[model samples]
Target: VLAFTATGFVVAAFGQALGIDTLVVRNAGAIILCLVGIVLLIPRLQDGLSRIATPAAAWASRQQSALDDRAGLWGQALIGALLGIVWAPCVGPTLGAAVALAAEGKDLGEVALVMAAFGLGISTVLLVIAFAARGALARWRGRMMAAGGRGKIVLGGLLLIVGIFILTGVDRQLEAFLLDHLPDRVTEWSTAF
Candidate 1:
């Protein structure tokens, strides 16, 4: 996850250096995220994807096998970097704004720190879910199986809502509101990180 976020930061910096419009890239990312959520939410979309899934899966498997045989830890790192590109949409809008700030000649260290924090936050949640929630996940998996993909629907709804919020600029408003309401010290502490 650190690798993923770092890759994103590097890519954004490179893009900015190249005179690319980071805002446009960010908007495109939001659209991609929305499309992913929509695909998950719509059954027909899933059905359409399923048609291509087999061939895609076969090719992916073959690639994975080759990577495993040839690359070891480096292969995993490469995969993480690739995932960073594939999941750029998953980076919250704050990072997008941060990238913009960097492009505007604000401190690059601040942007890197934000990306690191974002990566850590995601990693922590995944760790907690993987370790602390193992038993709960097992039970939830059973229930999900019985529920005929209610789980997917619920997750999809959440992703869709978040995507819409980010795309519509509601997230920036929320962030501003929070900053306005929160203690200065609290905000400072986050920056200190």
Candidate 2:
């Protein structure tokens, strides 16, 4: 996730340096399109199609075993990285904003810090969930299982909504709204940069 986010920042910075208008919004749209494509193309993901359709038992077992292992901090970091990569599709908006900022061609230090902040924000939520996951899973295994059964339906609905938003150009509307409402000072600053 860090790597991906950093890559996005760099791309954005490069775009800004080139004086690209709407760099953020265009790139964000592209990223979302990429995610949609990946989800459609990946056989495993397409087959599962829903949280309920996922092999929760097997996944939970694996997570439990991995957590129980006496690994060092590096192992945890690696696991976290892997998890972030796997979860990237779900984190599109946050990353897209960070990258758009990076494209504004900020100083290297600033860019690094911004990317780090973005990573930290994402990691915070994930870490909290990971910490409580085991207990939550154990206590609500039955309910979770039932939820899983309806996972595909939920996922399909979400995908439908996302598709409609994208196809109907809602992103452009959002971009226009933001740009129209930005403080004059910020717009001036962006142009000056």
Please name the candidate that would achieve the greatest TM-score relative to the true structure: 1
Off-target runs (Cα >4 Å) in candidate 2 are 1-5, 14-76, 82-90, 174-193
Which lDDT tens digits does candidate 2 get at residues 40-158?
54547766666655678679768756865856576666676776555544555554555555655446566656566767776689879999796888999999898865775566556
Query: Model 2's lDDT to the true fold?
Result: 0.63
What lDDT score is found at residue 170 in candidate 1?
93
lDDT (0 to 1) per candidate: 0.76, 0.63
Clashing pairs in 2: 12-103, 13-102, 13-103, 52-148
Could you give candidate 1's per-residue lDDT for residues 12-70 as a string of tens digits?
Answer: 57765677676677577667768878888999999999897989999998998899789
- Backbone clash numbers for all candidates listed: 0, 4
lDDT of 1 at 49: 91
Overlapping backbone residue pairs in candidate 2 total: 4
Kindly report which residue stretches of model 1 are placed more than 4 angstroms away from their true locations once superposed: 133-140, 146-148, 173-193
Model 1 RMSD, rounded to 1 decimal:
3.5
- Candidate 2 TM-score to native: 0.55
Best by lDDT: 1
